[model samples]
Target: MTRRWPVVLVGPMGAGKTTVARLLADEWGVPARDTDHDVESLEGRSVADIFVDSGEAHFRELERQAVAAALADHEGVLALGGGAVLDESTRALLADHHVVFLRVGLSDAVKRVGLGSSRPLLLGNVRSRIKTLLDERSAIYESVATLVVDTDGRTPGDVAGEIGKALGERA
Candidate 1:
């Protein structure tokens, strides 16, 4: 059965996409799926493990495919890996979809993300790394988003409620 389209969430790491997506899934009366989780399960390894074992290029290829397939097949709330928006094709697919950007600042992301974690990209000088990433990808996220939700200093439920209100308005 074709369920309602997945409410796609995209943002920087630690921006609460996963948490907000779960909450939105409930509000939308549909399921939630994270493309990162899908990739992990498919490879039977953590994303960090994938990077360690296969390398960044390989992991990105896998992430690209997983995001592409999920965008095509998932009929629920879908949270993408932070870097997923880098792919032009994936960004193209997001057009006309209820794509919510969980926007968060570097300070907020630092607080939520913490230092020394599994995030492969934030491996060195967490602050500088995050800043660099934001510089690189922030514009892309804004460009692809249908609705932008600031996740700083907000509960997942609060963001979800805001999105629910937005979705209600859309309907």
Candidate 2:
């Protein structure tokens, strides 16, 4: 069967995936779920805390499970964690879904992430890390995405509108 209700937003950190997903859900009048939020809700801890306490590998496991559960639970707009696409199983689950890959360049990502923040991965030598992560994950994201969106200078509303248009045309 063809799934028609859920729209999955995938992208790098600071790419406004959550914001765009929320707007899309609101515009489409569907519920919205973020995998990061799921991890936090399940662990009773913030993402930063999860990283600091449980380590990245453990946090990634939690994220993967959360993504799967989210996919299984509802038909709505799903905003995935930035790195969720790194897992092959998650990509397969999203194969037939409406996946939008929000693309943000390195400089833009650094600016949006900000210089002073509690981002676990961005805590040390974040610029290089962001570049490295983007390079490694861009291919995976591209492979799984049904559509590509460049959100370099667009507001959430603008990006939402673009996504809606794309969805409409494809649907």
Candidate 3:
């Protein structure tokens, strides 16, 4: 059987989606695409800058477009921005693909991101913000995921390997 083209990774910020996507793409001999990076390339700025300049609604629209284009065009491991799944259309688009949700706990996420991170959403009280995001998005991530991988204490390589193994089993 032919393997799936894009193995999409979705999770909260600091869940290592981007890192694992690169590792998985390398292991699988394909390229890796990140929606956030796509947006940055198109806008000529960082995600934080986009959020600050145009506000979240504008950034989200750009993100939505980036995701749709990537889903349709790219054949690789794709990592989505943490809140991409919040858009219903994006979630619908993901229904047919292999979606992996990288699950990380509060403490782990805080440690991974650090308090001084430039992520727009985690502006103040980074720990509290992460917890809030996790609490709000966990169920949605699970609902859309074909596979859920706990990343609390795992390295990117290990997570990628597990995802590769799981996808292989599914195939």
Candidate 4:
């Protein structure tokens, strides 16, 4: 089925996709849906726990399904997991939507994410891992995005306002 969303947020970890989605939802008076949350809800566990128990491959499959379902059913602001674009089908689904790539510099991303074990991808050498993930995923994020918003040194409200303005222009 064909579907469209007011805004779909995509980026690497700590790019503020989730926070900005909620802010945008509030501004637009719509619900905010996150694929990561959906996956966690479905699995009844945290993302980190899913990674530990079922592995990245299993978690990715679940994420892909969650993204597909969210795209089909949700009409509100949607936020994707950092690695959701890794799936070809997910990228295809995003092509027809108003996708915003939340760009963040390496230092900002690391600072926002912190040296937390909660993130499976940044388990060791957090800075290096984030840098590598950002480097690897930047192009893919850009490819699927209809708009790009830099979140570096910006608040979630500011970013949401910018996105709201941009979406308004499109409307």
Q: Pick the candidate with the highest lDDT.
A: 3
lDDT scores of the candidates, listed in order: 0.86, 0.87, 0.93, 0.91
Candidate 4 segments whose C-alpha is farther than 4 A from its true place: 1-3, 169-171
TM-score head-to-head 1 vs 3, winner: 3
Candidate 3 residue pairs that clash:
none
Stretches of candidate 2 exceeding 4 Å from the true structure: 1-3, 169-171
Candidate 1 clashes between residue pairs 3 or more apart in a chain or in different chains: 6-76
Roughly what TM-score does model 3 have, to 2 decimal places? 0.97
Q: Model 4: per-residue lDDT, tens digit, 115-147?
A: 774799988799999999999999999999988
Residue 168 C-alpha lDDT in model 2: 81
Global fold similarity of model 2 (TM-score) = 0.94
Per-residue lDDT over 1-171 for candidate 1, one digit per residue giving the tens place of the 0 to 100 score? 223387799999989999888887876677899999999999999999998889988988898999889888888899999998898888888995788898998999998989876688888799889989988888899999888999889888888898888777322
Supply candidate 4's per-residue lDDT for 119.
91
Candidate 4 has which clashing residue pairs, if any?
none
For candidate 3, give the lDDT of residue 97. 92
| Number of the candidate with higher lDDT, 3 or 4 | 3
Q: Could you estimate the TM-score for every candidate? A: 0.93, 0.94, 0.97, 0.95
Model 2: lDDT of residue 36: 97
The ten-residue window of minimal lDDT in model 4 covers: 1-10
